[model samples]
Target: MTNNSIAQPLEQAKSIAEKTVYSILFTISLSHLLNDMLQSLIPSIYPLVKTKYNLSFSDIGLITLTYQLTASLLQPFVGMYTDKKPKPYSLSIGMGFTLLGLMCLAVASGFYWLLLSVGLIGIGSSIFHPESSRVAHLASGGKRGLAQSIFQLGGNAGSALGPLLAALIIVRFGQGSVMWFSLFALLAIIILAYIGNWYKGAIIPKTKVEKVQVEKHPFSARRVSISLGILIVLIFSKYFYLASMTSYYTFYLIDKFHLSVQSSQIHLFIFLGAVAAGTMAGGPLGDRFGRKYIIWISILGVAPFTMMLPYANLYWTTILSMIIGLIISSAFSAILVYAQELMPGKVGMIAGLFFGFAFGMGGLGSAVLGKLADSTSINYVFHVCAYLPLIGILTAFLPNLEVKRKKIA
Candidate 1:
């Protein structure tokens, strides 16, 4: 980097700190949509891959385990390093891996190759999430909850689209058609390049660390650690239940209702679309009220629907899934933003840790649940996962950082 450009960060940071940058927020959110849509393609195509390669449920579970672990394991380190190094162009570079993965997936001859393809995509996701999340934080102008929700909205919306797209594109045209999605990755790379340009000038350089005015939360480290643990447990409960839906909901629908793959995907799409709407509302609601209350309500509020989900008929199943999606999906944004508030200056690290933990839970959940499905039935798997959200009751133990912030002010 030139000295002239390098000297510009203080001015850029001042300019950025002045107000919320909606343009950048929307741009990064769009990139998130593209990135997650690619990642979702793997699970969305699970039925196709399972049949095409003569795979069992265990094989399907392994594919998710490989990808989720790859994505989950590296995320914290990536976030920690970038928190210090601040790589402006890394987002664009990460999308390159996704592009290659999509190309590989289109022609994957066997299950192992499919695993490799997804692993690559997982790596791309590990790199993309923490940094893109940091960009959302930087552009927030102190409205962190709103910023994160907008960012997550893109991801949730993209995830919703994946199943529908897979049904329309890959299912209709067959496995080779997966290559068509590489185009979106290519587009993301270009968009992220522009984002990188903006990011380069908008933050403090890695070569220099300025002292930041951290707002004290008036809580001890032990309390913070305890709170963090509670958050992790909540994440475990949430993602485990979600993994059941995202990974095996289609199977549940087909087996119980005797629906086509395309019809099942449409059902999944509707549920996830509700998730996207809930995600959009979550952050702003957290911003308006308190994150603690939002967290409590979001996680525990969906329990009744989940409890009833396993026993519903086709029509009630669809309605209950929508209710479950909307309520449960709202928790992540609030949880993430609350954690970020707990550790003020460690935004990237907190984001990485939470996002990583969430992914790990999801991967682990998929593997375990897949085994259960093989041994029992998809119906039984949902019946078991239905009770996981009861763990959300632990949200009560968390101290109110918002009240603390007000008092400190």
Candidate 2:
């Protein structure tokens, strides 16, 4: 080919690739943002719910438990189905379920109804993750780590926005406004999905499926189990950190730190924003170096900050909180990527287990930690939880199989 002709085609191909990548990231991030907003809004709205419904601590815990249990229990099925019969329909199906749950919440009155609605929302949350991870993985030509990280950053972004934005809406429109906000987010997501043509089967290879039995990785599976255990511990610690901050942060600042509500909110916003940025960075770094390294580093790096959280107040605490937020959250993107990669052949199932068991159990841990904090000092809990990540660092040295890229034909 002539030099000019070759150069023109190469540039065109580069442009197309870049556009496709941006589109993929945008769609993934938007869906995650919506999901996280729905998830996080509950904690933010707790005080209002308590006043209106006369909810007790146990009641609040139960409501939260409903969401966690449903999501955890159903994830395996969602994952397995997606891996086996992977389709673009997965995203829409998940969105449909989520919308139904959100609608239910919007109209709900009694506490039982609210619980059921949130449970449904959790189920909906469970359905999409594995399928989405698979799609992201395929889209990136099997650069699964980076893809997973980018995908998760979207959710973290939503998490960061949920409290600040939803708090504003709740103040203006009252508690029920949160439900309306979720519904709006739901509708927006559906519309965006259609507009982006996110349903295109770009991830699926045009090949026939054959029932093939392959040798199971008995050794790797054992290692994965151990790794899963390590993650569970890490999850427990992080969840405690998260729940403490989300559920009681403002109160803590006011009571313990002696800061005003407005100041606490500002610090909280900064902390969450840093977390979102850290999550985005973690994924690419994991992809470039290794997931294990990121996890270990995050554990080690964040521990001191978490420990310092109880001692300092005001400016120092805010600075410490930002540091803790970044260090602790960096693992999420890497961990999600790691979990999905663990069961390479069944991306959905792996996603389910990690998010379902590891992540879900972490929520439970948060509850326990919260109870412990109520009895003792929240500072004590933070210090205790810091050690769990250190344990994870020990397991970081375990062997991991490198993910191989499938060559395009």
What are the TM-scores, per candidate, against the unseen true structure? 0.95, 0.83
Clash counts for the predictions, in order? 0, 1
Query: Which ranges in model 2 have alpha carbons more than 4 Å from their true place?
Result: 1-20, 106-110, 188-200, 206-220, 258-266, 377-383, 400-409
Pick the TM-score winner.
Answer: 1
How close to the true structure is residue 310 of candidate 1, measured as C-alpha lDDT?
88
Mind giving the per-residue lDDT tens digits that candidate 1 earns over 1-409? 8877855875565555756889999999999999988888888998998998999888898899998998888889998998888898999989999999999999999989999999999889888999999999888877888999999999999999999999999999998999999999999999999999988876753223224345456899999999999999999999999999999999999999999999999999999999988897789999999998988988898999999998899999999999998998889999999998888777778888888898889999999999999999999999999999899899999998878778877
lDDT of each: 0.89, 0.66
In model 1, pairs of residues that clash are none
Sequence-dependent TM-score of model 2: 0.83
